[model samples]
Target: MKSRGLLSVLTFSEKRENLLFLLLNEPKTIAEIKGYLNVSTPEIFPRIKEMETKNLIYKENKYYALTPIGKVVAKFFQPLVNTLHVIEENEEFWKEHNIEAIPQCFLERIDELGNCRFIENRLEEMYEPHTEFFENISKSELVMGVAPVFNPAYPAFFLQLALHKVHVSLILTKNVFEKVKNEYRDDLQRFLECNNTSLYVLDDISLAFVVTDIFLSLSLFYKNGIFDAQRDLISFDESALKWGEELFNYYKEHSKEIKSL
Candidate 1:
């Protein structure tokens, strides 16, 4: 059989792949590697040997470390693995939703939403604010959101957050803004008057999401163009929060700030 290439060397075995990842941060002695991976010397040594032969790793002074090339590969490889896991973990969600609303830049970094979980409302709770989302934002120091759809309760609820001195920033679609201005004028005015609050209006958007200091909550329209009110993707990971903030900022930059009405 022809010798397998570097791709196979890197990907063919889970042990080898994990060993490379373990070495990414720093070199490790065999004892450290064995303990970290919970594997015996006999099982791990052969994988390490194979990687060493491929020049993906090197040993010196009783420690194993990735070579320069290995470092580069791992740097790129980790993100690929993370991205795949993120999509595969929520394959039905990704397939059924309208992700085209997400900007290309943010879509590329989707892996930053590490270990996100779905929040699916029960049948009786359909169209209600997600309880977990509400509870998290209530305790957060800062809250930012994009609202492409309007809920009757949101105007008063978000206004209450602003009044409590939570830093609140929101980008609303023009239609939603109009609804708030016409029917919730009092709440809207008070929200705009708060020193810690800001509001902006943009053209129609296809998704709604919120990013707070503690979490991110994302809702998308279905492929059939109806908003999916029953499910949301939520994450408490720091990287996910940062990613969500960037996404909010991207929309904020293009929106027109509303000072009154």
Candidate 2:
């Protein structure tokens, strides 16, 4: 098979793809592979033989391992698979929302959010605080957020967290900043006075997200430019948390810090 044919060898069969990823972690004998994959010998043997012919895997004593070429393929293939899974898992959310709010660099690493799950608010619950989001952040030692739109309850809620000694950081859009400064002036002042809190303001953005020591909560605007208050992507994975933090820093670098107001 030509090198181009190798792509089919890896993707055409789910069993073959699973076997490749199973072996990526460590070499495994045919019996171990069969048990781990829950496939019988008749089903798995042909895959091993085909992979052997493709020079993607080789047998040594009782073990089957990836060849040098196979390792290179797996290194790049895994990320693509993970990225697809992340988007496909929430196809409507990705399609309906303003994904352009995410910077290109971070969009390239969308696989990092593969472990996330959606938290949807019912229409009747739209005005209520996300109980899970608030509870999780309240327990976090550090919290960071980007707010493109204002939520009336957030000023006091986040201020309470800052007062409780949680290290809080926020990037607000110009309009949101003005709302906080004008309506929640006292809370904004005290939040800024806290040694543990920092605030920055930037021009309008099209998304909102909160990343904390324990979790990440991301929300986006609809294609019609309305903020989707009902759906959020939340993740507790370490990689997702790191991805969210880098996203916060990206906007933070572009925002101006508001020390007093």
lDDT of 1 by residue, 49-98 (tens): 98898888999999999999889889988898889889999999999999
Clash list (residue pairs), candidate 2:
none
TM-scores of the candidates in the order shown: 0.96, 0.96
Model 2 C-alpha lDDT per residue in residues 32-139, reported as the tens digit of each score: 999999999999999999999999899999999999988888889999989988998889889999899888999999999968888888899886668888788878
Name the best candidate (by lDDT). 1
Per-candidate Cα lDDT values, in order, are 0.92, 0.91
As a TM-score, model 1 comes out at 0.96
lDDT of 2 at 30: 86
Model 2: per-residue Cα lDDT at residue 6: 91
RMSD, one per candidate, in order: 1.7, 1.3
* lDDT, residue 109, candidate 2: 97
